[model samples]
Target: MLYYKQLKVLFLLIILKSCFFAICVAKIGFSTKTPYEFIHPPQKNVIEDDWYNAHTDQYTCGAVHVSAVIRHGARNPGESDSKRIANIHMRIKDNIKDGDKFKLLKDWTNQFPVNNNKNLNDAGENEQHHLGQRTARRLKSLFLEEDMSAVQFMVSSAKRTEDSALAFYEGINEEIPSEAPEEFDSEVNDENLRFHTMCQKYINSVENNSTALKEYKVFGSSDLINQVLEKVIAKLGVEKNVLEPADLKTMFVICGSEMAVFKFSPWCDLFDDEDNEIMQYWSDLKKYYKNGPAYRITWEQSCPLVAELFTIMDDVIAVIERTEEDKDTEGYLLGNMMFGHAETLGPLYAALGLFNDTVPLTSKNYHEQKNRLFRTSEILPFSANIMFVLYECEENEELLNDEEEEDDNPDDDYRIQLFVNEQPMLIPGCKNLLCPYTDVREWYSDISDDCHFEYLCDPHKKMHNEL
Candidate 1:
């Protein structure tokens, strides 16, 4: 009897081990085969139209300075990305057995426009034009007399960004023709705009540190993802061995890009709400781990940008403070424009603590995605912009009422308002959307103190191995 019981126990252990191995394999295969499914879709062109329609706030005190950090306008996919989509489309056409899914993909890919490079498309041109036109109109009082010298522009190294800057200039000229510079000094600094390339610490800790994002990897292969993958596989009538999540998402990417450019795609209807929510969570996971509140160093990566903004604002304030008697002072800078990619823009927004989830994003909390605050589609869409408007509010009403000659200074009354994508944003820990300049300055000063370039770049560095 004892010998028989031992044999049964050994057999049970073997079965359990085999089952565990199979589960591991399935999870591994899911992650390895469907890498693209987790990547967020490129910026949609329609977001530009949305911004144009958003109501602009009329400043009661008047805006003396405007700063805009913007994502470049819409563009086509790169050669490799397009090739992947094309291959997936061809595979679905040749091998997909399901009638509905096959027909849907066929109709969608048939209408999908082709582009082989990342240059700005016609829609991109219109998007940038609209941004400039709308911004110029809002600040029309400041630009009543067109003087390009009052404005400054910083563009990234990419050709698309350069073209975007030019397009925006053209748009401003549409309304205030003389305000747009014929061509002034524009700096192209990849160091400040593309800090990821230069920040070795960020690359090591966030980009290359596989161990740091183990939760993300586990979440990607969780039961929730597996169930969604199974649903997608069944919908397409393809065996698990033959089809992968990456293949399906590539079709989705093409569908979304086509729809954004041309305003419609049949493939958009292929996925139900469940599938979209799962895929969006996947993208959110990557973003959260790579450059968001989840990582301690993510915000530090954007210190240079925050510092530069303060420097510009300080210079402007110094000029404003110069006595009216000082004729040597050139008028304070009215506006400054910057154009860059979402890779940098996303991190900058993260540094500002925008859209942070109250609950931690973990595998255990994956089901609570609705409450997870990071939404890539809403934050990093094409032509997304973060604008800082410096307002000069009415100052010293008591003194004016007392019939005094006036001791009020615009610099003392200056306040800063934050706007994201043409809509006002109320910063965390602040009472209102419009915050006092001193409060903003103090907040940034603290960030600057914490942002020691050497320490941020090399968190592990130690002088005496002391805390």
Candidate 2:
């Protein structure tokens, strides 16, 4: 009887081991597949009707400054498993009020598969590339025939952002010199320094909290808590980690010379205002940490949690219209490159007021052009707008000449026009010329259900003739 009992126990252990291995393999295999579905339709060509006779009507002989903001192009979807993991965790936490039960299940289930794809794929890359090219081409067509090398260029630090900038610049193919200096390598080094400083700050806070440290031990997993504790202890032991603080500091300076400086100014207020709400949810998640640090949730578990809150924060930020004061301040650039999953785009667009709003396009709208031209392809289920902003100095009346001088070329005039859905509309001019059209109404007499519009010489006349 004793021998048979021992055999049964061995058999049970083997079964458990096999099950654990299978789960691990399944999770690993599931994560490799694309998380989001890619949807591609037929590409449309730029219609000839989109080009209006701006030279005859609204062409201003003076220089004008323009700015634009646009959405990034389409991108690949997120990991399927991570989404699954987040959904399961959130669902369990929401439905099961019992703390002990939650912890018990969470600890056991945390190893399961969750969301999946983590970066942009081929379609996303192409979207950004094409969008940038189209935007650049359109800008060149509106501006003078001179090389665009003199234009000041700023881009976000994301992969897609950088790619978009490169593609756009290539498309323009003008010999214009870059207004900004090239410092890609140095800028990357500075970002690394900034990240290290943030990490040090977090470590310092952890060391100062004796009660929290104890709680961290009880609630947090041994693996993560111990790793953090080890790093803190090592920092206290030796000054070796202290590099040439001066040299390091110099390397880390966020300067204008850097190709990518992520200034959180415009969006900082949005994030700051929601700190309380974010912390509240974070605090709630702490209750489950009886087995691990709340903030230390794995990427798989954190993606959904972060995504949902981020979406809400985006909505809150979108309502904040830029004040006159904001307009006066120097602008913020999103970055030249963006990596990670595509879901990051939704909240970004929501914050920028790109969708679900009925703000009619007008002359004043062009003033906010810089914000309107920002674009990316990392976010799925959305199309990106390729907008451009051209800035020029105020005109000197003394330079004005009534007759076309022998040297003046009529084909090389400076005018800002927009091509929307194959319909051309002139943007509001500066102090030099009177804007002939007020809204889209003057261009398209018959209001069609389709968002597309066509140019009309005189809408009132067209209606009168029809009558």
Model 2 agreement with the true structure over 38-140: per-residue lDDT tens digits: 1222335533212222233324232232232223333333345334434543443454444453343333232212232323334344544554444443343
Give the per-residue lDDT of model 1 (tens digit) for 1-467.
23323444553453365457445221111111111111222232423222212212322355778888887877766666678877766665666786664564554444323564577766677778877877887777776685877788888888888788888877877867763346745789775677777677777777888876776677667777777768766777766765565655565565555444554344544555556666666666776777666765666677877777777887777787784569787787778888887767777887777887777677667666665557665666667778888766654444454445543445446678788877778876677777777778887676654666666677465222100
RMSD of 2: 23.6
Candidate 2, which segments miss by more than 4 Å at Cα?
A: 1-66, 80-117, 141-148, 174-383, 386-467
CA lDDT, every model vs. true structure: 0.65, 0.28
Model 2 has an lDDT value of 0.28
